[model samples]
Target: MPVVPVGRSADNAVTTSPQRQRPTIAIVGAGIAGLAAAWELVAGPDSQGGDGPEVVVLESSDRIGGKLRSTEFAGRNVDLAADAFLAQRPEATGLCDELDLTGELVPVGASGASIWARGRLRPMPEGLSLGVPTRSWWPFYRSGILSTGESLRVATDLVVPHRGTVGVTGDRSVGDIVGERLGRPIVERLVDPLIGGIHAGGVDDLSAAATFPQLIAASRQSGSLLRQLGRARVPAPRSAAPPPLFWSLRGTTASLAVALAGALARRGVAVHTGVSVDAVERAGPAGANGATHPSWTIALGGSGPPPTGAVVMADGTSSLRVDGVVLAAPAREAAVLLGPLAPVAAGLLSAVEYASVALVTLAFDPGAIRSPLHGTGFLVPRISTFDGRPALITGCTYLGRKWPHLARPGDELLRVSVGRFGDSRPAGLDDDELTAAVFAELTRLLDIVGTPVETMVTRWNGAFPQYRVGHLDRVARIEQSVAELGGVAVAGATYRGVGIPACIGSGQTAARLVLESLSAGADPAGRSPGRVDPTR
Candidate 1:
């Protein structure tokens, strides 16, 4: 593929248009999803055709990785955001295999996290599926996380079973289904801490269809929810141990993004950081041969390096005219960029909400802890209180214990997470105040003796997008509106799943969508024939 020369212009209009051999696609945002999209454009089976599309990725941040980041802590590299990805989801592991990093994939060293209930840390019950007891009731009853009355309420599911509708209904909140079946106590104690913690929001408003479809599917059965979930479980061989629940790279899960960015760069894809996309608008009318014309114009800002093939306007701004575009940015940013082209998509994207969270990593002398660190970590339900107030810390991870590679003889590393949807207490406190408060809670929960040897706080504002009831419908509308713009698509956690694997899948899917649109010579104002499947 020949490089499209950069041309300077005194006006906002594109000044150069030379015949090109391959289609050029610009990907906005350099996060995992965006990087994944660029990879697909340059190396996927479709890209194997002749010369692949000229791909360029732009990010507003100074670095390539978005929320997937790691830093040196206690003489080892530790992840500040997500530490691992679900092994059941193949995207992350498949990406690792493709990058030849499969050998570096490491399963979590520990298991069986506990929950703080009734003023004590109790081991989470076994045979639980996303916090709902799927197997026998004996294990859950013996865990002692619930009171006698609460246990009896849970037993009602088996004795006097609550029969839900015979078929799958419209979207319902996770909290409503679980509370109705098992009891409110179960939702408050078990379900909220596990499922709710994943999205950093309460389950009461979270959409079951979007978040936990397994639960929703099981709920539709006539009999017990527990029995239905148990039947749905795919059994493993009795002779072998179960597979690992989660996996991370040897260095850190963050390395997945780093490795992906490197791989994209190696494929001749221009990956630029600290560059923000200002707007995405239609260029002039299609050429006599519609397939050859660049249909979209992307306005660029920020002090980041100019795109290698961008047209430099006299106003000092950079712009790229591309055959297609993938708006792989965050929901808010995508909304702003799509406002001029797709007002419906912009409005729906703007309405999506996000949750902020802080992870405080602290290292303490091994001897300072009174009790032995067990399992990976423990979760604090929103209802759990500390010192007569609602708990400030949502959960805590024994980083060194969970990832043995990070363990040191001198100190034990702990990561404490705070804040969630509708929780503003953490936002009010500065780093020092937040760290101190988290430590105080840790001191009581873990029976720590003194202060930490080192402390670091990482804040991820607007990190987790809430999947409220009817979220999937909203995403469908957003996708449909954008599809009408022809050769453009949006991808990210805000539209689909938020896990690393989900984000990767979302990006690849978006790539395929735009590629189809461009190859078919889609009309900019006409409906796209191949709209993305929202259920994916």
Candidate 2:
């Protein structure tokens, strides 16, 4: 392996002169968050009208996008993971507007979805706030998702007055609060399937403060929990139609990452894939004068030979020296890198757990369907059973119906999700067996007749970071410890949020911290950086 040293080209030729030397910022991952961080470093307000910092992105995998990926299936680009992002968040849309991709954005065509309840597929109750019905009686009674007894139990929230203000006092699990107010039936049938499905973990231990802070505020009110949540909702203009709940790109959601990577290349940002970072160590002694920040040396390893002009060490390892770094890798990888520098941050990161999931895309003939496929698809509650045992399938999406671009005249495309935190059933089955099992469940759920024409299975292991109780406090401590290192910052799903928008915001914030340190020569106060305005 050859080492590509700083200030040198791939052919061992000097690229930048000593007179034109500039600060170099290294981003440790090439995922969406890392890419967003690189963007903020070069394209943000601080970089405009001047020579920007030299930015380089390193990724371990053969590809750039982490869990955001797509493939050519059934002659169209189909997402194997998340297919859309929440439209209410501005980070994703704001970044797309800057990338000249605003015209390619597409809104969801379908609305509403079903939940498997009482051994049948029933429409989700209207006026739901994250699976907790805001309107107490009519919607639940009409949908019939809950039994007559369960429906009456929910109605009690309207008349019953809870004693304590536990929600506002401190951190608590989502299930603990919802079940206490709305009854256990709602938690098992609605809350777990929706909220739990989002994190790929049971909400019984999921953090309410981190995931849904609004729930806490609503719970503090004295009146009905249902009415309180209804009042808490942000109302749209009375005359205007409500905006789309989610958005996706024309080709695939993964195009956002690809487009961002190309934009980075055009701006002279070097993005290297298939390279693993072995360690991050202090480069040398601190600078002279009033400088308190220390530079860093990053060790690199890969299967291929090192790029020419790299500083190959005596041990045959390549290394690069950068003034600052954005550690945007996952929690496990971040923990390993921070162990030597910030042990507290490393230990906190190590404690953050992740969940694995698998997406199975199947194409069926239009004639095989027995019931009209309503809405986008349906979700299976954790308590649901099939074949006299717990169901392995969690949810399913009608790809062709939801995204008209992927529709075919004779083909009905469906994407089924399997596996969640603490569920090992999907892991035990091979591709063929898993596909068959999912198909069998679908046959009963959708009343299908024949086999699928084509099938594909994609697995994402440890993709979702579980936000357990007290997650936000833990994140605060982690950031404080990393800030003490002066020029180092952490970003990605593990800290703030897991959605595309949240991850993008996380990356941009980290970039701002690095920029501040680089400009001031050091961050002595170890203060938390403010969020970069998405509009800016």
Candidate 3:
């Protein structure tokens, strides 16, 4: 491996360990990634007596753990927002155990889904298969979502010949793959809404490699997704998981914030809320690890000049001089800041797109809905567009049915996520207008005649990131650019993934890079043993 030259800090110590009595590691965002990095660095299997990385978590928001908001409504707990991270992801679940939060972990309910495709609440295709179909007509036959013809079309995937090679380096759009394998209707009726809801992109715009990589891999390995029925290794179930683990959480996801906060606290990480970061830059000694920009300097006051180190900008900030750096913010945020500094990386980051969304949580009386929300909830297909934007009820969860610990029988919770990219409702619409719009749509779709008992509208201006086709190429270019820049590492939804697990993976990966860089700088090994390839 070749060594990259970098600026060095003459003052600070090169190494950090628990035995040093005081070792500090700074994290900019308090979201799962930031908190997870803090948890692992301070409390993971690596926590030993060699001067542990003392952690300092800074947040621009008033609270820590961005987006995972579980709150109270009408005296019962609710997760109006992000529910649970997929248990199969393992990163988030693993942290839960490391933090002793194993008991708080809960499974999602699986009463099944109600589709609104052919215009009715039919059961979601019997064997979900996500975007991939298994039984010829499972989704169409089993789901009220599609027609018999549509079901037949979807089954055709069994014979859909392999087009391109798929692997970590391969890429394909969900729309392209689905439509090619399954006809247009199945793509529209089943694939559009289901895959669209999760990705927040028009199927044509989302990447199969990034958004539904597993399904893509399955399609590759099985050679026939339709035939791999009795066998697909489904997402694993949790200790107290609901519905065998394939959907969102029942209650509000706010507790994820609470749990993470508790974990960071126990590990002695200083949580700073309501503080904003301005920029990040490289200035660390080229630790034997070529990736470590050992000296990092950051400007904090938003206007005044500031601090530096292996500075990790986990916030929604821009470039600053720092030795080691990690960016755990969203894709757009990363692009905005890194654009001027690392144009190639920034452009690649920019290539990875995002979609806007609005989530409306509605609380209804148990008797109002046509059927009990048995499982997690229903999903709205991207095809069911409202005013050019996909408008999906995404099904309502019978909060009372899923979790025994939450909600009374009479009190029911329904989270109706509304909108996808550029939904043109009047910008001036009052809260009442938004609320009315959500309820009206739900009532018309689910046959619920009554009004919601409670309501909330969360507008994530740029909440969901869209990973498009050719995304892999762009990210690879990004990695190359950053590698040349030296000593700086980037993580978060922008490069690798968007979910909680993806973000956790990205952030920890950044930390690991920094650690690895430190290791490389000191050790003659030059890089991780596996990474030391002479092929290049």
Candidate 4:
């Protein structure tokens, strides 16, 4: 492990002479997480020692914004990846507020979504908490997805006796607990679709404690999950209006990323795109030169050219020495960077698997769909099949209906998401093949009257991380181990969460750890792990 110089003050942290040296911190990766980290270092309050340190962001790719990207299409802007984020979570909305984007933030439309299952599109049952209906029978039975007998079996959950404290231990899969209490039918039809949609992973493999804390907390009570959820449900006040449950910029999400980069530029934080840091290693005591601050040697030029400014400082070499480093790449990349330095943490990170999903956006004439489009979109149950085979397309969202701004009169824009965990159909299909498949599915489900005017197919390979059972435990261990390494911190969707908000929070928190260690000139292992609030 690399050891930072611990004897020098800010006045003489890293210079050869008596002149003072401002600590130089390098953020590897310019994705949302990496950008968020730079935001923290340059914007956070001055440390007890003095002012903030000099910083630089290095990205392997020419483009920024890892997943939050949007572009002009169909004469309007639309997100290619995630369209909206969970507004209920403060991490993302808080960033929007800080960035002064409140006015542009818009909630999803009033239209709700339907479920495509049992060979039909049925209205989703009301009172579903991530697929667990509040009651046993009413909504589930009326949904028509479940038969009368199956509906009665769900009702048994309300009267069923205790199963010796399910989901009370370390951690369990959502499918296990939900199936044990509510029945497998509900797990297959309801839980898998909603929760699985969010993670793109199987409910049977997802960690209940890590993914649905609220459900697990409520389940610990005396009643069933349904009764507990019913008791916990708080009705909104009729007099007061509720805000939007999801939010995004008026334009593309990429605008936010661009705005953040511009903000970093204004702060004089060196921004370097198309530069990849191949390796991070300890400068060794010989390179530390008796200074108390830790020293790092960053190797560049594997994925892209090194930054121009950094190239000179590299003195014609492929490596440059820095005071500290923040690793904000995806889990797979992070694992590769950490393998030589922190083998254990790298191994833990490599163990986390990822899934690939493809999005097909199509524009059609408003009159093309003869039937009135109902709700925002429809999610196909995993059990759904087309011509006696598993359905390739997972879900569909009517963009124009959901957000009126994206379409003009007589225009209908639809975004279709295809693929799931352990499914290779999405990645295997080309643009034409995927578009035809999704279009065929949409026609089969909605009976469209005409062909699409324009269409786009975007494939995201290994973008979503699967939070398998014991995810929290793995994250805790990963963090603890990294803390011991002292001068480095890791942040991204791979660690705590996978949403925009979670990634931002993780970046900010990682920056804090790096800044703190640099300021104190001490080993991080001796101090508390980190300041990030895991609950958020």
Task: Find the candidate with the highest TM-score and give its number.
Answer: 1
Candidate 3: clashing residue pairs, number: 57
RMSD of each: 4.0, 5.0, 7.0, 5.4
Candidate 3 structure lDDT: 0.60
lDDT of 2 by residue, 425-472 (tens): 888999999999999999889889889999999999997999999999
**lDDT by residue (tens digit), candidate 3, 205-319:** 7788777766566556535555553256563356573344523333445665667778667666666676555455433334423333244454453322122332223452323
Runs of candidate 4 with Cα error greater than 4 angstroms are 1-18, 45-50, 135-137, 163-167, 231-240, 285-287, 302-305, 308-317, 524-536
A best-first ranking of the candidates according to their lDDT comes to 1, 2, 4, 3
* RMSD score of candidate 4 (Å): 5.4
TM-score of the candidate numbered 3? 0.81
Q: lDDT of all the models against the reference? A: 0.84, 0.84, 0.60, 0.77
TM-score of each: 0.94, 0.93, 0.81, 0.90
Query: Which digits, one per residue and each the tens of the lDDT, describe model 1 over residues 252-339?
Result: 9999899888888788887888788998767743452444333677888999877766776667787777778898888999999987
Residue-by-residue lDDT tens digits, candidate 4, 377-478:
888878888888788778888887677667589688889998889999877778998899888888888878879999999889987899998999888887
What is the alpha-carbon lDDT for the whole of candidate 4? 0.77
| Runs with alpha carbons beyond 4 Å of true place in candidate 3 | 1-24, 135-144, 159-170, 218-225, 228-243, 246-252, 284-293, 302-323, 371-374, 385-395, 426-428, 483-487, 522-536
Q: Which pairs of residues collide in model 1?
A: none
